[model samples]
Target: MNWYVVYTKPKWEKKVAEKLSEIGIVCYCPLITQIKQWSDRKKKVEVPLFNSYVFVQLSETDRNLVFQVAGVIRYLFWLGKAAIVRNEEIITIKKCLSDKSVSDISIVSYKKGDKIKLESGIFSSQNAVIQEVTNTHYILVLESLGCILKMKYKKDV
Candidate 1:
């Protein structure tokens, strides 16, 4: 058996893992808990470490069985063969999941000249000139109109 990357349908990482597990295939969907605030309140939620992918351990002899799982896009591959992911990468991800210090990971201050992409919301598809970014918010000068707008984007943005 080897570790393989499974490309999942958009936002279907958990679902795919479930289906695979029910069929006795071992899978891993690493996640980190995040505290998010909406207009009215704050809540903690678990989110996938990788947005659209999950890892699985499967036998090279049973490669065809993997494709039968719902929501599995395909096994990540190169050069016309299944690609095996190194075990060390998975070990590191597992460490991060188990580490209490993960929540204490520092947020570096954003510099004026840094390039950024919008990760979500109305302007999710555009890039902006970052005027300033902080632990919880960012001030960007939207490129299209040259207007400055302040947004409270998630840390990963």
Candidate 2:
């Protein structure tokens, strides 16, 4: 069985995973602990690692079974087809979560003056030169469009 990504309603990731588990569907909802603050006090809470996403392992024919549970909107699609998550990728996510000491495994190492291609968005398939790198975002110069773009990404990566 291959792993597929399921899109859940906002803030319903954990609930959808739980319901899927109750029905014998193997689902994974990675969570992390965070300190949340309100006007009065701050408390620790477990939040879904990836917002609105849950991973499930099942056959292609059984993919429809996930829709039987509430809060499941649909499968995430890539290139007009349901996206498939590789087995090794799942294991790696679990491993990194378990081992905090592991260094950041960013797929692309961005330094100043490196030319890279924007894979998605209107700038997609266009090459951009790295202008600056910051703690949480990158400043790229897309000369073809005569505009500079700033992209923000997760701090963990």
Candidate 3:
């Protein structure tokens, strides 16, 4: 069985995953704890790590099984074919979500030549070596990709 990505209705990731699981479909819906604030108080809530997305493991013949559940839009497609999620990538997500160190990441100060493993965003699960750091952004070298990435950072005022 191969893991595949599924697109879900907005705010329905968890629900879809649960429904799939109930029907004997193996699915993963990564979640993260976030602090949400209200005028009266603040609360910690678990939200889908990837909004409107869930990963399902099933045979190609059983791909349509997910449709039996509600809130599943469709299987994610890439290059005109269903997108396949590598097993290693799914393992990485599980590890990151359970790892505590990432929850305490503080990039307030940077050290040149420091290597970091990204846990989210486009570079998720990729390792990058910090080449240069500035108040606005960091220049990172992704040896695996054999390229340098320069992206902006937003800091609270």
Candidate 4:
């Protein structure tokens, strides 16, 4: 069987994975733990590493089984064919996420005026421009929206 990617509804990655697994379909929905702080409390939560996406291992004969699962939008396609992910790539992601030290490593290289898409957090998938870079954060200017946001570099993008 080959691994194929499926897109899920918003916040449905975990649910879809669970449902698929219950039906005997092998599915993987990678998650990351993050500490969230509020005015009076802090808590750790697990969030999907890739928003709205899940991986499934199956053959072409079983492809319809995945589509039958609720919340699964569709399979990701490349050049009109389903995209295949190598087992090694999935293993690497699992290993990296398992290592706490490497979890927060951000390796993006951005310069002023470069356009980028936010890959995580509340403003995820929003487009912005790099206004400035400091020692620990990026100053982003959302020109069309007339807003400026400060964010730390993250590897998710």
Model 2: which ten-residue window has the lowest total lDDT? 100-109
Residue by residue across 1-157, what tens digits does model 1's lDDT show? 7998889899899888889889888899887777889999999977787777788998888766767888988888756877787788888779877988657432256678777787778888677888886866878988876678798856432
Q: Output candidate 3 Cα RMSD.
A: 10.8
At residue 69, candidate 1 shows an lDDT of: 85
lDDT of 1 at 45: 79
- TM-scores for all candidates? 0.63, 0.67, 0.67, 0.67
CA lDDT of each candidate? 0.80, 0.90, 0.88, 0.88
Q: Please write out the lDDT profile of model 4 over residues 7-106, one tens digit for every residue.
A: 9999999999999999999989988877889999999888888888999999988898987889999999977999899999999988988886775633
TM-score winner between 3 and 4, please give it.
4
Ranking by TM-score: 4, 2, 3, 1
**True-structure RMSD for candidate 4:** 9.6
Rank all candidate structures by their lDDT, best first, as comma-separated numbers.
Answer: 2, 3, 4, 1
Task: Show pairs that collide, candidate 3.
Answer: none
Off by over 4 Å in 3: 104-157
User: Tens digit of lDDT per residue, candidate 3, span 1-157?
Assistant: 9999999999999989889989999999999888889999999988888878999999999998899999999888878999999999999889988998788322245579998997788999999999998977989999999999996788641
- What's the lDDT for candidate 2? 0.90
Report the Cα lDDT for residue 115, model 3.
88
